[model samples]
Target: MFNEEFHLEQPIRWGMVGGGRGSQIGYIHRCSAQRDHLFQFVAGAFDVDAARGKEFGQNIGIAADRCYPDYKTMFAEEAKREDGIQAVSIATPNFTHYEILKAALEAGLHAVCEKPLCFTAEQAEELLALAKKNNRIVGVTYGYTGAQMIHQARRMIEEGMLGEIRIINMQFAHGYHSAAVEANDQGTKWRVNPKTAGPSYVLGDVGTHALFLAETMVPNLHIEKLLCSRQSFVKSRAPLEDNAIVLIQYDNGAIGNLWASCVNAGSTHQQKIRVVGEKASIEWWDEHPNQIVFAEQGKPVQILDRGQGYLYQDDEAITCDRMGGGHAEGLFEAWANLYRRFATAMDRVNHGEQASDVMNEMWFPNITDGAQGVRFIENCVRSADEGSVWVEYK
Candidate 1:
């Protein structure tokens, strides 16, 4: 069970670079970071419009002076303060991520950044190197991996319950943008624009989330090669796909497929993953995140509910259960879990402990994972653009 009383001696002073007014992503970031009283939201460059950004920041209880006109200004000004921000969250569009994150790290601040960490794998590598040199924590919000059931799956797989994992299927297909909604929606507009959203749309947007889930569950598998085919179903979003399929060959001889689409008409966030092994298989759906379907060969299927005794008793998994079985805990809890880990990581680093050392004690999606996601996007795009031929994974 999660301990509500758990807190750092002094909450990490946190700020934001985006996720201003009317931004659902911003709200989630704030809620999750402050949920367990682990972070203190003290500043932000909330929007492109300085006036509106300041207004929004003030409305949310931030001091007007702390909400600067832009991220650079915010970082520069905050550094002179006696109580400067030690960490920041970048909630901006895809293109701004690399620059803002770079600035944050150079400013000696820990960061929690949105996915598709940068436009290219090269950029991701640079960020990784910069993070290491600065000894800063770069937490990528692969939010779903923080779910308790995910850890449960990891434990089960580690225990060889899913013997010799062979096949993995992952998808995060949804129907929200089936008909070119970006025509009027600002949020959707930036996402489809290659300048703002990066190389592939659905691939980096939702595909990485599913990929990370599989990675978390079966940590030993490594992609050796992959073939990808992508389409911009709503023609106008050209060069940036609205749907994509990736077929992967793992070094361990495991085969996997990923389907990421926003055109799965009539579907509502159909994010799911199914892992098959020689002995049995396990499946999880985000819609019903609290349960896992366990099917052993030649036996009746079983449903593994969260927080149950039958589940693994590992400290990481058990402690993630915010509420006992029979209660509901969704994405908010999941994001908060990651935030808690991020705070701990930042705190440890601040106290002269190494980031790698902290990781050895607790798991959180860090810079390395973010770099891998970016590399995955790069590989998928490369394969798709070249007539969808099988390409050796770099």
Candidate 2:
């Protein structure tokens, strides 16, 4: 238990799993976790290959004795140490999320996991159950919602700046997998295999991010129904969809469409969102993440840029941190916000600080958010398989 201070004066001791020599997502998680110097990497399992994992541990300057061969061993042994990791970040493949997250929860450590959380709704539910049982914090890396512009957008909606949302438009596109790569690229091979990537590829990969973005931006946004169409542009390129479009109906009567694809040539990641309301409309593009355009029915378009509150103060922009207006902050910066929020919340809990009324007002993607992503994917797949019919998403 911590003293009355309960301050984050020092970095939180942390560990990693599955971010070895060439892990893409793992590297991003590591970068984000350390961005604010709020976390100290003290241990890790690192890889499935024992030798490679050990090498990574040593290269990263982790104490040899603290390194372990498998996540099971790492979690178990770390829990025994007085200076063990307070949190663990999992960067393994999609299929392994449930198992690794469960292990971390079981060992009584907070976790930050890469998105989609798990492959199935059942697995997601189990993780949530376990998280609750152990009183541990579980954060999913839905980094899009972490963007400062997004926070500003959400604040605007909450404040009725955009009166009565009528239409919500979003799109997520990627062209990295436009052509087959499994034959020559071992690193991306898992993305093309069902056994490794799970049932739905594009829908689960980028769709979840869009879904979370839509939900996060709107106040109490609820999907009433959905209609989806999916196609395997490259039959052998990936086990599941390479492209899809989902039409969503919100309970508030606002309608929207979400287009996601991995085979759109030249589209590295062009995720964009636009919300049209009775009084005004707001649009934000991932490519131009630092700014948001707002326009009322008879008003001129207003462009909002990012900046820290201390220097260039804009109430909405203050929610989003920035070195300055022109100094760009992208994926890693957004992820840093998620990691910081998770650490702060967990830090409070670990100090025997009980959950307060203020804590309930806190924001960060958690196990519940993870489960909702799974729900969005499963429902979309079902709607697509059943001939793109209207599937109730209640």
Candidate 3:
């Protein structure tokens, strides 16, 4: 059991390994961490170029001495300080996750890293075991799972409010790469490059978020078999797939379909998931994140709004904002919620305690969830490469 009396006297000190100037994802990570008021950025290694890294750090108000040229130096020097960072955020590209994460854990610092834990399932599993050995908290940020309504859906499914889940339909579509930005833009070039983004670029980048959301909401279902097809619309601009589709069979006898496309001209940053059950069904979309369209077998569809008063499940209300009801709190708030919750758990672990059942179920996205995501990416690629032959999900 964890101590309720444990006091967090100060905001946890945190550092960053990436997200220097002109990096959109880096800005998002920094803003989200600050929004929660649970973390204070103290140090950083912001870019691959040492001069650029120092300049970026200085501009962001990180002291000249603490601004490091590389992640290795940041972790080492910070670990030596008495008031060193307790946690570090890895906002770098997909391929850099493994070494940075391992460094943080080995240095006795907690981590809140971006999704798709690593390039391979073996690396993901190794990182998970290392975190356990060090007794540290490792959080993978699945931003969409931070949404309040998503939690409500998870609770409803767990409580059997929606009978037995029968089908799942998920899609994440974007228009940014519809015309191939990689051909001209150097910043986004890594996304289409196998060396930086790993195999299955579309799936590994944005598609994995959809996979994690389904895994989080439908906890009882395990993927049994998968058949996938991946396509590259402009082969000259990008070698990796920009569009992909997947068909999944679950161990619990449910079926699922997933589609991811970067070439959808109008669907910019749109993501949605629909889970159907024997008695009722629920659907949610990021575009209109404040509501859930729920339907019963014979009853009319109910437009469920997110607020403390509108929730039947108490756990959902706990995630609601102080001044909610009509005011929209979307992406940044949701992401911050994940950070705050992760920090809370890290605080517990540092104080010599165990995370309660509620924390694991409702708050944290632990190592196991991240490992499964890596496995999903690996399995999906294998299935596609084998001529869409059904492959058993390991």
Question: How does each model score on lDDT?
Answer: 0.93, 0.81, 0.82
Compare candidates 1 and 2 on lDDT and give the better one: 1
lDDT of 2 by residue, 78-151 (tens): 88888888899998888898888888888888888887688888888898788777778888898877788887
The best candidate in terms of TM-score: 1
**Candidate 3 segments whose C-alpha is farther than 4 A from its true place:** 1-7, 237-239, 316-318, 354-362
Candidate 1, 244-339: lDDT as tens digits: 999999999999999999999999999999999999999999999898998999999999898888776756654567777889889999999999
**2 or 3, which is superior by TM-score?**
3
Q: Candidate 1 or 3, higher lDDT?
A: 1
TM-score of 3: 0.94
**Candidate 3: tens digits of C-alpha lDDT, residues 153-196:** 88778878789999999999888888868878777788888888
TM-score of each: 0.99, 0.93, 0.94
Instruction: Tell me how many clashing residue pairs each candidate has.
Output: 0, 0, 0
Query: Over all chains combined, what TM-score does candidate 1 have?
Result: 0.99
Specify the highest-lDDT model's number.
Answer: 1
